[model samples]
Target: MLFSEAQEAFKKHLIYREMSGETVKGYMKDLRCFNRYMTDVYNGAIYVEDITTDDIEEYMHYLLDERELAPRSRNRYLFSLRSFLNYAVKKQWVEHNVASEVDPVKVMEEKKVALTEEEIDELLATIKHKIVKFSVAFLYYTGMRVNEAHNITFEDIDNERNRLLVNGKGKKQRYIPIAKSLKPHLENYLTNIRGPIDSPYLLATKKTGRLSAGYINYELHRATKELGWDKNVTCHALRRSFATNLLRKRVDVFKISKLLGHSSIKTTTVYLQLNENELQTDIDKL
Candidate 1:
């Protein structure tokens, strides 16, 4: 089959499988780019069944060496190709999964970035806008993901219990204990700024609808840029900062994992990088 024909088939399969629109678009775009590269570089057509292990390796090299794509991006391309080839093999279009033979690009793990206490204070103080300021403070204190923070509602705020029920990843429900320190601020925001919204979503847009994650991110980026923070500060960074600070304060990792609604403690381990003393103590015990 022609490359375009194969592309349409893959797209249809993704749609049938109920993949997100963004995911479908990304896979199609990556595959199309690969097909174009094959035609331009090798002066040959690449049918779905005609893709080989060598072709995949060459494409990876082209992306890394020629295009200088980051390891994460290179891995994403590999993943897209791999999924396509697996589908083709299942349909008996290809004799084997060529992508399986091509090794995935290795991504080097970097230390998770967290804000120092001073930096967090600086960030909070720098936000001149009342709404933005409280939003940042809420993120820091609650350790909520940007999406979860945006979705919080007055109903979710159990003031009597001092805990908030959050709908998290995979639609899992978990209760996060709100710090008593933030109760006053939360009450103030609800009473003054977010008055009588029909929508249960706590953080509403200016017109009193649920806020989009993009808007929250844009505001955060604007604030961080204005403050000239040397480090990269994304909305998710607040979540990481919360986790790291808890670990630094000797908070139980298992408890942190549970609070974060992580299915495995292993996922939380990444955030708990040991200090030199901890590492040395472990080594000395051996």
Candidate 2:
């Protein structure tokens, strides 16, 4: 079958399985890039059967060498292609998934720098946009991903429960405790800045409805620069700060994993790096 033919079917499968809109868009974008590469490299026409393992390797090398994509980014492209090829194999369109045989790009592990509480306060106080200020603080306090926060509605928030029902990654729902510090911000945005909470989404833009992740990141980075913070402060950075601070405050790793909505505790372990004081305390305990 033609790659394009299989691509459409795979897209439908992804949508049917209820992948997030952003995820579906990313897959479509990667597949389109693959199709364009095949046309350029293979003289204009290619099929699923025409693709070989070597071709997959060459394309990865092109991304790493020519495009200078970071190891993680290159691995994501490989993953997208592998998923498509695997779908084709299940449908018997190809004898095997060549992309699957390829190894992922090796990424060196580096400890991510989580923002300090003082930095968080500085960033929030500097944000000129009232809606963005609340949106970012919401992420920092809740440790919710950008997409998960986008899915929140008024009904999802339980003021009495003092928690939020967030539709997290992998279609899982988790409740994050709302601090008393955050209550005023939430109350103000829902009752005033957004005006009537008519759209149901916790955060709304001037265009109406839930704010997009793109807008959140753009405004966050812009606001951080205005505060003279040269570091790349992003939505995820705020989420990381929440988790790291909790760990520093002696929160259980298991509880932190649950709060972060990680599919695995192993993912959460990456953020468990100890500072000098923390290590000294552990040493003293021993």
Candidate 3:
């Protein structure tokens, strides 16, 4: 089968397997770039059977030398191609997945940035957009992924119970405890900012009805730039802050793991990026 035909089949396979829309989009984008490289450099349409391991390696070189993509970004491209080739193999279009033979770029482990409470307060104050403010605050207090937050509806929020029913990854449902400080933030947004919207989503705007991850990131970037902050302050940063703050408060790692809805406690530990002073203070105590 042609690589293009196989790419379409892989896309449908991804969707049918219930992958997130963003995940599918990312995979398709990487595959399309690979397809373009084949057409432009290899001089024509390439069949899945004709693809070689060398072709995949040369593509990686193009991404590194020509496109100047970072190791992490280049790895994403390689992974997408590897996944597509795997799909092609399953469909019997190819004898094997040649993309897998290519070694991925080595990425150094960069520590995640977790916002301090003061920094969180300052960022929130700098954000003039009401929905964006609420969204950031919600992530901080609840430790929810921006996508999980986007999925929230009125029915999911239980004011009386003081918890939220989060539809998490893999369609798993988990209830996140609503912090007392966050109660007012939620109440105010629902009562004022999101007042009587036709959409059922908790973070509805009059223009788009429901908020998108793109808009949230764009607004967040703008706010961070305005504050003259040079760090990578993202939606996931808020969630990391939640985990680290909980750890500082002497919360059990197991409990924090559950709160973050991580399948493993090891994953939660990665988010606990305490500052140097905090590390010193804890060491002194010991």
Best by lDDT: 3
The 10-residue segment of model 1 with minimum total lDDT is 270-279
Off by over 4 Å in 3: 90-92
lDDT comparing candidate 3 with the true structure: 0.89
lDDT of 1 by residue, 1-286 (tens): 7777878998999988876566788999999889999898768876777777888899999998999999989989999999998888888888888898888878897655678667788887777767766787788788887777887877888878889998876567899998876777787887787667677777775675777667666777777898887666767777788887788777999989988778899987765655577669768988
- Candidate 1 structure lDDT: 0.80
Q: Alpha carbon lDDT of residue 198, candidate 2?
A: 52
lDDT of 2: 0.85
| Model 1 steric clash pairs | 152-202, 153-202
Sorted by TM-score, highest first, which candidate order results?
Answer: 3, 2, 1
Each prediction's total of clashing residue pairs, residues at least 3 apart in sequence or on different chains, is 2, 0, 0
Assess each prediction's global lDDT (C-alpha) against the native. Answer: 0.80, 0.85, 0.89
Write down the TM-score of every candidate. 0.73, 0.88, 0.91
Clashing pairs in 3: none
- Runs of candidate 2 with Cα error greater than 4 angstroms are 16-18, 64-68, 196-198, 227-230
Model 1: how far residue 138 lies from native, Å: 2.7
**Candidate 3, residue 199: lDDT:** 91
lDDT of 2 by residue, 90-139 (tens): 99898888998899988997656688788888888888888889999899
